[model samples]
Target: MAEQSTSAESTESRTVLSWSGGKDAAYALFELGTDDVTELLTTISENGRSSMHGVRQKLYEKQAESIGLPIRFVELPQECSNEEYESRMADVMAEYESLGIERVAFADLFLEEIREYRENQLAETNIDGYWPVWNRDTDEQIEAFLDAGFRATVVAVDGSLLDLAFAGRELDSAFLADLPENIDPCGENGEFHTFVWDGPIFDAPVSVETGEVVTREVGDGKFHYCDLW
Candidate 1:
């Protein structure tokens, strides 16, 4: 864990952005100014891969570099229980609170339950949660992301919702046009996950090459994720 130094209390709040190294997160930071942001916080698996998108640590580092922010990665066990997840996250929040950080921003869109859960959790520590891309239409958001000059690739897809071939596919008009009606255009339902490699917010585009696809089963759900190196 990375520690932040304590500073004098101020009327203005100190904030951190929850980064997932994905298009949504990248877009959120761009849409929301970063002048008061403390750091980019993210969660990674025990093996140093992004817990959600499965992007490797090296690629994540490149993303942070391109976005020009210091990232703090919270490590989670390979097979952690929900209880452990909450405990670990609580500890991280407590640490940030001690440093005078008062809020964390997320990139959730049209997910009331998720936003509510995050707010509830943060309320426990007197910290607030901000959702920059909340309540937006998925189709419009995806189109805006592309029009903003961001480039991303589908890194993971829910095995039950999409074919394995969806992994490693560029996130563009063709990809969105090919998605089934049941799938959300912005992947807000977790039908798929993406890795943003370039965008207006990035100082430089991240260089990556697709690698072998790997599958993992969690509970009854399976995910097919492609590696990038």
Candidate 2:
């Protein structure tokens, strides 16, 4: 983890973004601007998939490359406990703090508990947490993402809240319009997750094709994940 830092000091305060390889993370990066964010950090399972969005490590590496930023990956065991997760994250945060990173950024919107958790974690370190897209209206943010010519695909969906068919669909106005009123347009409530491929910030589009949708049962809930390659 210590080897991940190659960051040099700049006049402006530097921040590391907690990237999930999803639309919200991409939009947050856009909102925060590329100049301030020094690096992108993501947690991955032993299987080489992101912990939250299940994006492949290779694919996300491409995203970071296209965005012209260095990325750090924290690999965890398949069945990691919360205690282990926090312990590992704390070490990473401490490392960043030692490297003079003043802040860490998240893409949380309107989730009080989530924000509180992040705040509590950062309270233990010298670094502060930054939320560029916090408390904003999801509808407007989604509209802004589309208006900015960003393109993404729905890579995963909560089967309990959305149909499995939505897993492989492109994220566009039609998809949002078709979503039930109960679901947040930006999927802030974990109703769905997206993989951004093309956008204004990216140097080139990540060429990908949706392969198959596989349902996985975790605890009492089901998640439909679409494979991209």
Candidate 3:
């Protein structure tokens, strides 16, 4: 079995990484040594087996396997509004509290409001939010992560700035430098989302091919996703 965390010698102060089944979560887990982390898991919305982030749940389970981490289940219904989302989060934190969890790690690249929101939410639950890659410039950080042997593919994107051609394409330095100015190279602003295929943090690379590009519309914008498998 993989070793637990070293966050506290007491074995009670367990720290968890919030898995998004994306590059940020993978990157954060990469930063933390397995032994230094009590457990790595994800919180997902499972209404209709669809994730709140619009990904598949089983995909996250597969991802957890790749990282050799176990994921705890947190499911919610679909199309949850802000109030509903907060309620769902509170319930999840309640479970965490029951598990004696005190620290949780997040993989947010660079966002002020999101970070602040996480901090505020965790504060109410007596849990501390740890942002491993907070405030770092997204481009530099993405490049460094890639140079460190991290590999990724464009799993999803905003249709306006990107297209299906980017899906499942290897996220290398060349790809980073060549990204169109319209899209955030780091995808910090939700211009795109990526799934890591290889990294120093992985036991092996995940082989996949682009399937299709689907778009999810929200207001005047749309979230474009490259189906990969």
Candidate 4:
């Protein structure tokens, strides 16, 4: 019995995934591991509130259970600016410092400025940024993320760059192939936003209904989003 148990435990894989309510991070985690990777999903929740990127804290709790992974949450405020963002990140890092987190990962793909920012930031800390999906052609990247058995919808779009109709549609090859040439296929320039569904990274898919397609004129441009519930 001891030998059998030891063998089973030996075969178990482990890793931690950075959580965001989006497809890029979901796909990165999918490629990294699928079965019980450390059981810990980490994310920064809204300050004083227990949610990540508008995801309910309880929902995340259920998600971790469904994936058979444990969860760790850090909270931050909704109106956080760049300085505040860094301070909160420092706090999270301090708590996990002794645990020897070999690397940290993100949902980024092919945005030079964002990548540079993350890399430079991590250079100041013990943890280093690991970009799993970087520099791939937009079509190929989107196709791969889709073909990897993951699903996602456009949760938001910058109205100035995209039509409001794009706010709540499934991300499939056809939609991607048909994207207007002027819009960045990956939305790297903030053309669109996504929420993930069934994928290799999830033991069970996240269930959400598109709530509302809202268009608001803010500053110099109008933005659109699909309220997800």
Which prediction has the highest lDDT against the true structure? 2
lDDT of each: 0.84, 0.87, 0.68, 0.64
Winner by lDDT between candidate 3 and candidate 1: 1
lDDT digits (tens) for residues 193-224 of candidate 3 = 77776777667676556676766785687766
- Between which residue pairs do clashes occur in model 3? 5-37, 5-38, 6-36, 157-224
Off by over 4 Å in 4: 1-16, 35-63, 217-220
Model 1: which residue pairs collide?
A: none
Supply candidate 4's per-residue lDDT for 74.
Answer: 56
Superior by lDDT: candidate 2 or candidate 3: 2
lDDT of 1 by residue, 121-197 (tens): 89889778988888888889989999999999999999999999999999999998899999999898999999999
Clashing residue pairs, backbone N/CA/C < 3 A, model 4: 39-69, 39-70, 47-76
Worst 10 residues of 1 by lDDT: 2-11
TM-score of 1: 0.92
lDDT of 2 by residue, 1-229 (tens): 3224334445354789999988889989998888778989888898888766777989988998899888888888878899888988999987888788899999998999999999998998899988989888889989999999999999999999999999999999899989999999999989999999999879999988899899998668999999999
> How many residue pairs collide in each prediction?
0, 0, 4, 3
Better of 1 and 4 by lDDT: 1
Ten residues in a row with the worst lDDT in model 4? 1-10
